[model samples]
Target: MEPLNIQANQLILLRLPSQNIKVVKVEPGSIISLGKFGSFRADDIIGDPFGFTYEIDSGMKLSLVDNTIEFDEDDQMGAEQAMTGHKITATGMQQLTSEEIEALKSQGVSGAEIIAKVMEGHAAFEHKTEYSKEKYLKRKKQKFLQQFTPYAIGSTELIDIYLDKDPTRIYNLSPETLALALNMGNIRPGGNYLVVDETPGVLVAAILERIGGEGTITLVHENEHPNLDCLKYLVLSEEERERMIKTINWLELFHPEESEPVRTKTAEELEDLKPSHRRQYYRAKQREENHKEILKRADTCGFDALMVMTLLDLPTLIPQLLRFVGGSRPIVLYSEFKEVLVETTLALQKENRVLAPTIMETRVRKYQTLPGRIHPLMTSRGYGGYLLSALRVHPNRAVNAVGKIS
Candidate 1:
């Protein structure tokens, strides 16, 4: 087969077909050995001046346009090999399977690496099963996995980085994106914002990382719950965790009031105490100092917050949440799906405390193929996620008489 070239921002996904388990992501510039069958690096097949194609293990070329390779011999051999570990007779290119493709997309694997791996060894063989004859056509009909195709954003760019995390992964929004959102309307550096369905402290960490103002961020969850339970298993390095870890969980902050007045030096008399008495006075003050840190966790609730309520409950909860911040602040709501968001939005629109409420949706696709004609393709995964944004305006509030809209 013709030697392949690989490029950046792409990946290869491998799987255990029987178990539907994603085995690994093919790293760029690394050699993957299918054993005596052959070995190749994902980078070997990307960015070639020529388009994608396959050739025999002897280096005899075949173009996708020619389409002359027979699947019959290859298919039979692939089945035999899958069962008996027989080596492939020749090198040929094909696409990754649907499950493998989707797994790569979820991890934000790029397209370049995908194509190279396909050239290296796309199994053109049929998976053997008791229902093989009946399921054969059905399985063959599945071409590229549809969901793995990348979703379009507002515009295309020459280069973009993709990060794939698990659905429940703690996510910190990009500072640039947040900065743009904050500057959208009357949002300011220290103003409080509300989050729904966010991982514990992720959004807060993003905010704190950006505009390091003294203003506090309040966290809200249903049943007076803080979201720290979700953080117990995050796969972050210790260095990253140190900065991300803040005791935002409301349960961790609750303190009893009876512990107060642990100091007994009488206020007036305490002020006049000599340095020696003051030293002894502060010695007793250690307990109060410790308790202060504990109570501040809850009582010092930085930004006012509310619960995760149903669509019906939003009408009541949104207004109450607005009252806490009043009209001067901004409210951010994130929904996992759009229908509920539309319902929530309609309710908020009627309240008249909302100004410039917006619905924004973002999508990302990874592992794009650049140079191949019949590309070693994997469709991108995360297709239709959304974001809804709006400004909260109070009834009878003064209008900003003049400003250019973005």
Candidate 2:
């Protein structure tokens, strides 16, 4: 596993103080903005090791620093027990005026120094307990810190990036739901998979990561063009997509005979064309050959599993898609609404070709359970939705072999 470095003109995830992630391209000699968090020059981070926190200095230059903050628990906490931050804010909170803070910023003071200055103004600083002080310090850092971390875009961060940016874009498909679909589908490296992605490309991206570019993912889409636009953020190279991902629209998958590209000239006649003309001619011919191979793969040996994450009519779509899957293969479907997956399971149950069908919904929460200080994590929230699972099989009549004892 090679470490991915920060490169110019490539997308990287920028995590700011607000806990929001911005997918930014590091263009050389250009300014990268983080909205209210201010902007920084791209050159400051280019060619550096990725996933390291880069603190903004004087609003332009950046310095590498560890993002972790230590919260040393006091051994004698009983002697200093005090009320939380909310119980006492009468006159012990902030004393410095907003104008003074702006003045400090104009002087080009560092964020940590500015935070120290603000803490000096808090009259209740020494009276609070260790936990309360830690909470106050964290809030001050989030409010005044000009630090940001640039992370390499990969499968591990795509879920957090999308959920923070726009959950609705991916149909609210949480990390747990994505994992369930992959495991239930029996996805693995070097295995062939059939996918119908309507969560845009999040589901497809997850499959690509699990397969690790070892096998094929035949993506069946509903539009004239495949909507795997999210692959760019997961796997950066176009060549990787061309090699590992094969796409066929619904029309092409259902009726390959009618969707074939027509040839304008024979190979021998094409040879007489100029070099520039020959380049385009050969590219189209090769693409056509690849399309034929993909169709053949679907009609012959078949795929190992079939996975679906779509907003279309699954009750009608999934049954027809199951034909491309081999016998004993698993089929997993994801949907935010339980009723939709329940409807899909009911429709699959009626088709005797499927085995015991099941539908399930799940959720998760992050917690920090320390003695005398048990609570959910700061950013704790519930996630995940619903899934419908079943297995594909071939119908056969029972028979016994006739034999005579010797």
Candidate 3:
């Protein structure tokens, strides 16, 4: 395996002190501006290892630093002092005016120096309670810190980026739901999967990452072209992209014999064509071969697993999709609402083509993990979506005393 580094034109996640994330394209020789947090040359971060937090100096030079403050078990007293629920008056806390702060920013002072200046100018610094002081310091640090952490783009982080920036782009799919789909589908290296993704490639990207270019994904899409827009953010090489994923229209999957007949040209006919016409003819021939392969795969109906994250009606969709999945293979379906999965589960039970259909939901609650002040955050996501999973099976025939179709 190769050491992960920030590569040019790759999408990297820059997490600021305020915990806000920005997805930036690393273009060498370009300057990436982070508003008041200051700007740095893209070359400064390129070739650096991912997952390192760097602080920008007064001269705009980058230095590796540990941005997170670790709270040890021995710091219980300090933690208690920091969250004592004491309120302090905001007035007279600092004497620096907005103009003076702006001047300090313009002077290119380091974040630490600027913070120290503000702290020194605060008139009521000694008057505030310890908890209030700590809170103020934290808020100010987040506001004035000229630091950013670059994280390697993976499925989880990619989902987080979209969740923070535009949830609609990934169809509001949560990380927990995404992970459940992969696990319940039993994705593995060298396996063949049938996927129906309306998340526009987030699900597919996750699968690709899990399989690590060793599996095949036949994506069934309703549109003329597969909407794999989210794949643009992933750092897949050309060979991996070409070898791991194949797209087929839903109509084509349902009607495999509808593809056009392949056209073959004799040597005489090829010799008579112009150069451009000959190129066009070869391109068409290659496409025809690819199309035949896709149709052949669809006709086989023996995918190792089936994973779906689409808005299509599941009760109708799952049964139809299961026909292509091999016996005893897993089928995992994801939806934002439980009612949708509940209906689909009931339908699957009636079809008897699946075994032990189950509807599952998972929710993750994040806490503020200070030593002695641990508690659930004031705000958190309400839901993480639902998963409906079952194994494809071939039902045995019923008879009075011998096997027969019932």
| Residue 29 accuracy (lDDT) in model 3 | 89
Better of 2 and 3 by lDDT: 3
- Residue-wise lDDT of candidate 1 within 1-406, one digit each (tens)? 1113323433322221121212122456665543322344445444543333332131222222232221122233444344553333325555667677657645544333333344345354333432442244224322222111111111010011122334333222332333444444233355443434345444444443333443334444444444544222222244443322323332322324433465567878888999898877885575355435434542344233221312234544565555544443455554445666677788787667667667666553333221111222244434343345665544643433343233
Best by TM-score: 3
Best by lDDT: 3
Q: In angstroms, how far off is 20's CA in candidate 3?
A: 2.0
Provide the TM-score for each candidate, comma-separated. 0.39, 0.80, 0.83
**Residue 48 error for model 1, in Å?**
31
**lDDT of candidate model 1 versus the reference:** 0.39
Ordered by lDDT, highest first, the candidates read 3, 2, 1
Residue-level lDDT tens digits of model 3 in 298-369:
467688898998899999878887778888999998888899999999989886689888889877778766
Kindly list the per-residue Cα lDDT of model 2 for residues 1-406, writing each as its tens digit. 1137888787788887667778988899999987667789998888988768867767477777653342212222443352221232335556788789879887877676677677767878778885786688668877877878888766556778778777877777788778878899999999988888876688878888788878888888788777776666653467778777787777777787786585778778778899898888877777667678767776787788988888888888888887788889898888878888788888887766788788876667665433344466666555466888888887654521233222
Model 3: how far residue 69 lies from native, Å: 3.4
How many residue pairs clash per model?
23, 0, 0
